[model samples]
Target: MTCGLFQILMISFFHLIELSSQQETRFVYETFRGQENLYLDGSATVLPSGLLQLTNALHHQMAHVFYKESIGLSSSRQLSFSTHFVCALVPQPGVEGGHGMAFVVSPSMDFSHAESTRYLGIFNVSKNGSPSSHVLAVELDTIWNPDFEDIDHNHVGIDVNSPLSVGIASASYYSDIKGKNESINLLSGNPLQVWVDYEGNMLNVSMAPCEVQKPSRPLLSQHINLSDIFPNRRLFVGFSAATGTAISYHYILSWSFSTSRGSLQRLDISRLPEVPHPRSEHKNLSPLFIVLLGFLAIMGFCTLTGMYFFRRSKYAEVTEAWEEEFGAHRFSYKSLYKATKGLTRMDFLEEEVLEKSTEEISFQTEK
Candidate 1:
């Protein structure tokens, strides 16, 4: 009798699971603007222009932004999701390439265990390739990493838990007119629209420049069972960016996600926030440089003031042309000062008389 009851309960649970899988969740961010629905960490922030700026031109740093709430069907263990977003990867000044960014679906928001690196905040060297990670990342990588077995320096990859990609392709799109694969520069600083769709066991990633619409063919595609990856069928979606020795700025102008096929919200490219130029109106001077500049200014001011006072206090005797012409017959103030500096006038007169007498005696001897 107990076994019969257990069988009935199991059947009812299966029926509930079937019903739960039909629930759809949608999140669209046309512009962050004044919205506070995202949880940001590290160097992530929303620009005043309603853009999501991830990492700045800082090296060895990482930043991330996630939806404030977890996204998943509460009663289902399988989810078919699609996401669309417009993003920009601007190269730092004079930098050719850089570490990259990723669109990640993680089980939890706590990534302290995985230190940021070439992994793009997905996993560390130790945690990578471990099934326990339960992370899915669509990487838009710029820097070539041999450790991760990257295909090239500029490419898009589908990473499950490790930086190593299961499906990879150059950063480009298929042209219907050309009937071939054409390459695109990922670090061109231009906005690009990306679509990630996962239905059944197939995952597709497609992208094109903002000017170009979605291509008929995907840039890269692969078949992977997401249900097995997400043990609990729950996920959190976000953007993760990392920098190495090189620097780059990652940005997201808009993003939308949906569980229904072909129903992902489209971004308003015309109204999207612009990616600020690589060089701002003013340069960013470091704190140390500012302090040194201030110190130098203070020292220069002190030196100038000291010199001005010294010149003012020193004595200067000015002699006119008339004084110079008749100085032999006239007693100038300088002559008076010399005669009166130490000896009295009477003593000076006596010296002059002795000199005259000596001259007279010499003249008589000569005669």
Candidate 2:
């Protein structure tokens, strides 16, 4: 009986180890445009097994939405997943635009049922607004709307409970493709990088312009207890994009995810080239530049001080020469008293008496 119990205990320990090994840290799914549902060329590529690339100029209504469902995560385990996508607007002038793209996590892995134009194409029409069903979408919206032009051209939003019943939780107007109510300046498509972090009951979304020096701060943050969305813990992760009439391509470059046990580690930003600044023409110095600026400022201060003293000295020399030529001229106290004689109180009283006498004499003369 002791030996049998020991064997069972060993088996149970091995089983637990196997379960722990199954949890996934990083998962990348890339689908190109054109080739067999994958949209754009050179935008999406699958390097070996784990690595996936989503590049520019890719679009397809029916592309292979690559997904990794069992990221080795159990219901009890908590995870933080982030997706990095490199999407560029296809340079088409007059094409009617479509919905942009989304990072979605739901109970279903079926991509066919997830189809909607403006609404993230991932809703069960059967359970349209039902909270019992599983649905969550983080949308990167590119299209414009009359109601919410308050939001930016490229903005991030979250849709929970159902896809049909959606709301723009967060959004920011980005400078890339510019347009007014009628027409917009279609500059070269600007690349957008977005980050979404979900920890415990908190969900935070942040984005940086591709050329920005620093990663963008969180644009919108909403804290909903995970229990509100899903009673069960594990969720399948995938991406969806749709081009309704006018074809706009979307691409996912690379993605990484991590769980509580540290299953998937994200690549450090130090490993990648620093994101270029949007205004590269302005040669603004970093903190190191402040030191040189301080030196220059000190030099400027010294030069200004020297110039002021030199001008003051020159003025003093000129004044001395003028004083010598003028033979130290002075105003005497007697001259000052004579100049102010009309201002004395006695002068005022005498003037008043004279004015009265003059008035009387003038009256007699007139009579």
Candidate 3:
């Protein structure tokens, strides 16, 4: 009886350990296949290339796509997420790029008031400095806004409940496999990877080119308490982007998120899928190029229409002026034919000669 009791106690302890492991294993992952579980708003769409595009050739457009199901982010627990993506911003030659794109965890996924261009489709002019808007976003900004006091035209910004950045870093990546640092242009139209982890009171953001391994040192590390910022435990995770007169093509190749309060290893890295080959920047035409082509076509059509109306108006003016001078009684073809005996001047002259010759011949015969 003593041996049996000891064996039952051991079984119960092992069962409790198994339950704890299962509870911390929740994960959310997606490769954006056919816009499966995503909610698209505005210009967002799944392209034929299998990339999830947030915005297309439109100007003054704001677009975003969020997970249909809300992510259960706990204010008390730690969370880690890694996104593997590629973005191509083809701005007009002399003009600026877009406001930017951001990975956001917000109280709600609605962005109806977000403005285009410098606002990044995450917030509008009214919400820029507002305190009530609760949000945490990692922005890949390609343009500089004087209102936000951006450090440069190209940088990555980490924001808490505001469009103003708490921290900013010029976009760069490690060059060598041995972790030698190199600063490359962020908007060079290459693929990049960004990792965000929140553990304890620290938030770390690391970024690198897709070719290099993940960097050991984070570009930006700051201390903040998530519980204070986000009183609401539940949040929505997704992406947002916008364009003013400028434009860009924002894409999400793959993404994975884990809600585990345990080690980062517990979060499955294998769930993150591989991205497709980087698209050729030269092969893909600029959104401005397409816009210019459309504009020229419309202008050509308008010019032709104006010319047709102008000619029609000028002809009408001449006819009206002539009618005003002469009392509206116009010569008809039938009246003219009767007045000249249906004969031209040459025909009338020949007929007159024939009649005179016949009369002369009759006179000679009588003589």
Candidate 4:
């Protein structure tokens, strides 16, 4: 009986090793230079330095990026998983940037039914809230999507099967020193790190500047079960990004993921690629330019006004006492001045002579 029990114990130990090996999923792409294991579609591309760029500076576009191999999610028990990625969202300067990117985990990479724009290329309008979709996402949304009932224009959300979030919070990070939440703008055009971990039916999402270490307190901590999303299959982890009328370039500088809590590799900040800074879109008129324009406008108005009054003044007549003897036949000097057009006074004498001659002829005929 002792020998039989020993053999069974040995068998059980080997079986445990096999399951552990299968459950272990680890990958690191500090830079994607020569790696081809990533499956990119639509607008996704791997830059020269292994930077994963999803969606271009163009609008109304979508992209998907996924790891070639799938990671198994155990059905018998809830497994632990952690992933961290550094991303930089460089938006077109001087314009509102839309729709953002999401770290997605899906059982199937065939996003044929998905639509771009506010959907983040994950699902279409018709399937956004369907109960069967089992899509898990951590979205860093820049545009306010009223359709999804988004809380604000800039927020991070935990979504299941829909862009509409189960839990949402404005983009922010908890500062240990300040002991409060500090707001973060997702479109700030700076490289930032996002960490997601799921263990014991709890999902925690945290973010911080690339230079700072992970904070003790996460930005979001909510209960979630991965087993419920994918009951008996492996899931592919990747990113989905889309742009609407507003455009932004979404880039993943570095990424690392593992199904084990402490074994997940840390992203090397020093070796990571630099974020592309956006140009200053809010153009301000130079004070000198404004002053110059104002000076020119004032000078133009003053010069024209002065010239107008001066010309009118030249036609001003005092109406001497002798002028009233003509009664109704009297013409005002201003009328004659206007008829002369401010020049050629000699022509006025000839014009008056012709008029007097005609008047005399008419008077003689009447007599």
What lDDT would each prediction earn against the true structure? 0.84, 0.53, 0.69, 0.87
Q: Name the runs in model 3 displaced over 4 angstroms.
A: 1-30, 73-95, 175-180, 261-367
Question: Against the true structure, candidate 1 has what lDDT?
Answer: 0.84
Q: Report the lDDT tens digits of candidate 4 across residue range 1-367.
A: 9999999999999878658646688899998778888898989988776688897788788999898999876545677889999998888877788789999999888897899888999978888788678799999999887878999999999999888899899998888888888888899888989999999999999998876788899988889888778875678999999998889999999999998889998877998887766668568799999999999999999999999999788776666666577654655667876676764467778889999999999999999
lDDT tens digits by residue: candidate 2, 141-241: 66664443325444566778564324353344233334211122212344555566777657776555455432434556777555456665556666666
Question: Which candidate should be chosen as best, given TM-score against the real structure?
Answer: 4
How much lDDT does candidate 3 score? 0.69
Backbone clashes in candidate 2 total 20
Screening candidate 4 with a backbone cut-off below 3 angstroms (N, C-alpha, C), the clashing residue pairs are 32-50
Q: Model 2 Cα displacement at 271 (Å)?
A: 11
RMSD of candidate 1 to the truth, in angstroms, is 12.3
Off by over 4 Å in 1: 1-22, 73-77, 280-367
What is the per-residue lDDT of model 3 for residues 125-236, given as tens digits with 9 covering 90 to 100?
A: 7667676777788888988877787988888888887878998888776555655657756556555667777767677777776666667788878886666666765567
What TM-score, over all chains together, does every model reach? 0.71, 0.52, 0.62, 0.75
Question: What is residue 107's positional error in candidate 2, in angstroms?
Answer: 2.4
Answer with 2 or 4, whichever has the higher TM-score. Answer: 4
Candidate 3 vs candidate 4: the lDDT winner is: 4
Query: After superposition on all CA atoms, what RMSD does each candidate show versus the true structure?
Result: 12.3, 20.6, 12.3, 11.7
Reference-based TM-score, model 1? 0.71
lDDT: which is higher, 2 or 4? 4
lDDT by residue (1-367, candidate 1, tens digit) is 9999999999999887777656677889988888787888888898888889988888777788898777664344457889999999998766655788999998888776766658786688787799998989999999888887888889999999888899998899877778887898889899989999988778999998887778899998899987778877677889999887777889999999988867887877788787886675567799999999999999999999999977655423566888687875646444576667846557879999999999999999999
**Error of model 4, residue 141, in angstroms:** 0.5
